[model samples]
Target: MFASEVLRSVDNMASKRSNTFKVLLASLAVAALGYVLRSPSLYLRRETKSSLGYPKDSLLNFTELTAEYGYLSEEHKVLTDDGYILTMFRIVKARNCHRAKRSPPVLLMHGLLQSSDSWIDSGPDAGLAYLISDACYDLWLGNVRGNYYSRGHVRLDPDKDPAYWKFYIEEIGIYDVPAMIDYVLNYTGFQKLNYIGFSQGTGTFLVMCSEKPGYCDKVKLVISLAPASRQMHTQSKIFRTVTQTFYRMEGLLSMTGLQEVFSKGGFSQEFVAFFCQLSGVTERLCEKVIDAFDHVDSTHLGSITNQTTRVLFGHFPAGTSVHNMARYGQSMNSGRFEKFDYGREQNLVLYGSEEPPQYNLSATTVPVMCIYGKNDGLVDTRDVEWLMAQLPNVLEMVKVEDPQWNHMDVTYSQYTGDTIFPKINEYLLKYTSA
Candidate 1:
């Protein structure tokens, strides 16, 4: 009888241990969920006020001025092929003035992670938008889908939906640029418009020509600044690795509806702050990364503005998706503009069930002028030379002699008005009455 009682006690002990294990696991799960929920808020609070790069007020000022330059008196909107409503801001150089009839309109496309605000920063000086406007050329700035402005769609919400994020630079070329071109031409009542693109802005134009052949006909002239068509020479090892990893996980994340997790303001803003603190040492590291990623000379780290650096990290670097970065890595690895590999060389089946198309420069019949800084770390001079050779309708290829002018100098450098703007103005004036 005593032995029987001992066996019952043993069974009772086993049952209690099992219940305790279950409770521990449940508590762990709840803790993990709480961490996930609070992480974004913590990151946002830390990054929003961090002064690792430039002051927030200065960046905000720049954003405001850029918006002012693009504001149109009339309500301007366009619909993307995917049924997304894109908001466009316009500024007419001439109102009730005869000069508007003669001068061709210039459409300025900002690079990745940049909005229309990137074009202007309020100081004693003027931005490219104002300079072109002052030169009596009608300047219109464009904002891409993911930036601060132009975030809207019929079936997607960038803030709450993963479908909105299911795109990269390729989509911009295939849908965004073409739609903007069509809208601009239709609204202006012009047969063709002048095109100017910086960095990824120029890359998308190449994509448009590759994916859709008829697009170049709508453009009368094209000017590319720090243009990046091939990334084989790019130097950022971290960027390449991250992109490769992101591509591998894209499918899993999309399935889990966690694709929009990065879009959360808390997460994104915190990332910005973290990088800003790293900017002190990492800025130099960033220059090297950009140089290596673009196959430029890493030895030459030129002067970059604190504001420009902040914009790069807070606004540009973290803003792009892993899918986009993977495509860039593929482009760099192949030295060609092509679709991203979805693993096992299955891009053909995954991205459209066909081999990604190559950008065809011969189809771009527009008058194009390629401009580059001699010391640019992103778009190497050799790549630009090769790209120029591919184009059939080149108007002029101008290389700036300034050795200090790096990739961002075209937009942010103090000497832009004194050195670069004059050259651009001279070119536009040839086709404009002013």
Candidate 2:
């Protein structure tokens, strides 16, 4: 009886051990499944326009709209230099609108990680481009290389090749901006043109003057909104830290072929959706964080919608090349627009060691009127003041009184007309001939 009892007890213990193993395996499987679902692959599948927590269509109608499609047309064409085919859009406000016979035409440039579509926020009204065009100004929107619009015509494919993806604001300043400006001036039969840039758009302008000084003469006037000259003293600790971290990681990723992985649309869109979900939790939290990074006043948080928040966070910044991020880091650290240090500071050659040269502000003889917001985070008021002090001839410097106007508010905020457009119109009209 004792022997039988012993055998039965051993079997029971074995059974318990087996059950425990099964339970642990099942728990691990569940945890892994949850993780995979949240991974980029699964996230991409569910994170579409609908999944990003955009407002109901009916609700969006209530918001102030920018411009309609009627005012814009798209074309795929090659730029004069380097034969780089770029996506271009032309905006004509009036059929025969002519400024003073000598007044330069205006070319509008969008910032990094954004497309021309950014200028037009598709709801009820027109975007900045339409507003300027409607005010009787000939507006031409220029898309930088690698955004959804201007990705074209090179030996490198934005999708398949690392070379195509290898650029930052410096490249935009050196190649893309100059190419577009040349094309626009030549296409319009104008000798000099007015230039307006926002955020990275302004950074590229600085780059242009630094790398290609002759191009500055082609520009008659410049209007820089939220200009970023030296980013060493940026307001956002998070941006500073994150960008710095990414800058250091560029080498490892480049060697491993993971740099190009981010360029994939599937991965990008999924990442965007995941962030959008977080933004939806309480639009205020998201806006506050954005405000913190951008240096905007948090009180104006109500101005941004969940959709806009998602779009800006998810799609706008997108995947930047590690090399590009490193350059920004070097610029941030040095407080100068130097070429990205690829390991050697012009001494050691890893990739391209030539530090991007600093822009000569003295050469920017164009009549410039800078507009900045006190609450802007990306371009601090101090930087704007510093930039103004550097410029040889500044037509005017206007700081908006509204605490709500953020860096992006210049283009995307509803209060643009009340706080910004009126002032811009006042300046433009001063130059306009009756």
Q: Residues 1-434, candidate 1: write the lDDT tens digits.
A: 22222222223333345554344324323332331221344544334454444545334433343444452323367789987676666655322234443456788888755665556542225357666665667667777666545667887776677667677888988898999889888877887778889988898898888788788888777888878787666543433444444555667756665543233244434444344435354343344333433323445444445445555444442244445655665666666655665554575567655566566767666777878877665567777877778878888888987765666667656567776788777767665554
Model 1: weakest 10-residue lDDT segment is 1-10
Off by over 4 Å in 2: 1-69, 80-83, 93-104, 122-126, 260-264, 271-289, 296-302, 310-315, 342-357, 432-434
For candidate 2, the 10 contiguous residues with the lowest summed lDDT are 58-67
Best by TM-score: 2
**1-434 in candidate 2: lDDT tens per residue?**
22222223223333345654344334323332232111243333322545545433311211122213344344535462544567767654332334433245677887645666566552224256656766667667777766555667556665567776677776777788888888777887878777888878887887788678798888877888888777776665545654675577667767766443233244434443344454333343345445545554434454555555654444444234556655665656875545565544653454343554456777676678888888776677877888788888898998888766777776667556567777676766665544
All candidates: TM-score: 0.74, 0.76
